[model samples]
Target: MKFFTAVAFLTASVSAFTTMTPNKVASSNAMAFSQFSQQSALMAAKQVPHGGVLVNQMTDDKDAAIAKATVEIQASERQLCDVELIMNGGFSPLTGFMDEAAYNSVVENMALEDGTIFGLPVVYDTDDESLQPGTTILLKQGDLPIATVELTDKYVPNKVLECKQCYGTSELEHPGTLMVATERGKYYMGGKVTGLNTPVRDFPCKTPAEVREELPDDKDVVAFQCRNPVHRAHYELFTRALDDPLIGEGGIVLVHPTCGPTQADDIPGTTRYKTYEVLKEETANPRVVWEYLPYSMHMAGPREAIQHMIIRKNFGCTHFIIGRDMAGSKSSITGEDYYGAYDAQDIAKANAEKLGVTPVPSLNLVFTEEEGYTTADEAKEKGLSIQKLSGTKFRKMLRGGEDIPEWFAFKSVVKVLRENI
Candidate 1:
């Protein structure tokens, strides 16, 4: 019986597999897939964006496990059908089928039957999503993503969803327009904008404008802007927003987390999304909607903070949950680094009218022992169980394999992170 296994193997190799001279082309010039996988791994590492040339150059023989297997060439959509392909030559028990260094390098250029996408062998500066015919066009420049699309853009600038209940002129909000350090010619909103969410089962999925239009219109929606991993504070903020006495209704809370290539220690997009899924399932938060943000991190905490707010508006959200250092929380505040903890809220507080969505500043929430966001700040100070959690700090814990406190993070969110960390 013939079986089909779609392992990430190489298509060809250079001059190392053949007993015949390096340049000599013999009858069995091609070796087995295993041979190519092992040898090709070596050649792949030397080059920056590993490619087939490194594999083919391994030896004169082509020895993939299966000969003439179907392969999807990286960068371009040159698909080969019915050919044997070799796996990455190296493997490890701890990791799995391939060497982390070589496997990672090669996978970026190759995709298996599964939908795992990797970066390409381009020069460092030219790195981007694997460009293919069906690739999602989430980004066109530096770091902006399609997730910035507005839930309500008709009245705001370039917004797709109009505020049906908005009291003032239904303003069209700008889609994905964040005021990042503007020094005149350095950068400016080109009037072009993109959204941050789309339907997909995996990371790096392509954004379809047609598919986006198909999202069921939510007369009532709750937008969740996730720049960092999900923590107790995030939960506290959103639950409060959804349960707002004035704003609470039948709104759907969108589980929108940015999925673009974020820094290490920061939760991987897939892990974060899965955590959100578990949270969604555990809670009967009927109004919650879930989708990964397709944009990459700019590390511009404050400015990107405003951008997140504006994007939520395009998504048809009437309110957004703002976290500390929303955009640039990686570095320190005074060292020309992370956005100030309150910058995101500050920006939102100043621009709610100009941008249009109701921003939830952390200050408004009065954390208490009994309830998370209580309006008790006016009466008396209360001790909160949940210690303020930080994404940067969370990542350190993730990398360290330390347990995140249930108080800082929901018990469920912590469980998911522990498994994936």
Candidate 2:
């Protein structure tokens, strides 16, 4: 297989990083949040899974050390995202796909064998009966060999149970439920993965360790997660988070967007990346940082929020911004949301204390003709004239070549979206 020779140079390209002050503890009355008290100081280094060791399986340094007699298997897009995260230590602590024991534990209960919290069962599924226990397979995305997995177990998961347990519903209309029912194979393969290379991506994807190198050891990093382009309300919401008594002075906000596959109708990753780049350059908010995650959105709502918290903690974030209906998905057939609006915040808040990361709830910011932008509550308290734009209406305007007010979104972002469409 042809290898990516430039793997060694990936780290050199990362830009310089800045640090922000630690977040203030959430007040007792903070909505949908718990007061933060450091149980332990933030780790001097980034966190690893249960064993406190990063499972880096990449063999980029030595060609002769490569595994021989490997059985090649094609990987799907989601699996490819898993590979990149695993190899780059973005999914630190996970050496590879979950084995049967781990998978069963995660599925049945949101914990590992050792009772560590893990939201989803990261298993490798396949219909090929040829891949059995004790077989070693080279997982690939087309021609690129990304990792080698030594399969130790193969089992048929109870899809019905999984759909109910993990996603909270068995309805075929729910995207996650539908994925579990149809897209996934009948059997799952689990084992240790030895990374060969990271698949080439159109956008820059830095690993956890690389991002950690840029961050300061003593500073707190608040990460803002998004799957869509940022607009005026989003900008106001996150920037205001830093000013909250909960977030101490000098705290920085990391605009970390998922750049992998999302809902079929959502904006493309490349276009979103362009929008972020232009916004960062145009605004020049030194307190804000930019990064991208190669995560495949499961739209599992609350469980997915916990999953995101764990992932962000591994990425060296001290806090994560959790908005209403985080990672929430809807039923395509029924047009109804599967999870409650505050489900993610409630769940994440319940577990954030144990996860060692604080959950910063995003405020519902609105644009006002007089005040520019403010939280909805503040706007109402002051009786400011509020201006609103529905997402459906915004998309309609985009598709119709109608005017998108400057207050709603950046012109550069709109231009990119227009050009892409």
After TM-score superposition, what is the CA distance of residue 126 in candidate 1 from its true location, in Å? 5.0
Model 2, C-alpha of 297: deviation from truth (Å): 0.3
Report how far residue 69 has shifted in candidate 1, in Å.
27
- The candidate that wins on TM-score is 2
Tens-digit per-residue lDDT, 78-106, candidate 1:
00000001111101100111212222232
Candidate 2, after superposition: displacement of residue 377 in Å?
Answer: 1.7
Candidate 1 global CA lDDT score = 0.37
Candidate 1 segments whose C-alpha is farther than 4 A from its true place: 1-220, 245-248, 330-337, 363-405
Candidate 2 clash pair list: 21-250, 24-246
Query: What are the TM-scores, per candidate, against the unseen true structure?
Result: 0.46, 0.87
Looking at model 1, which ten-residue stretch has the lowest summed lDDT? 76-85
Cα RMSD for predicted model 1: 20.9
Query: Can you give the lDDT of residue 143 in candidate 2?
Result: 83
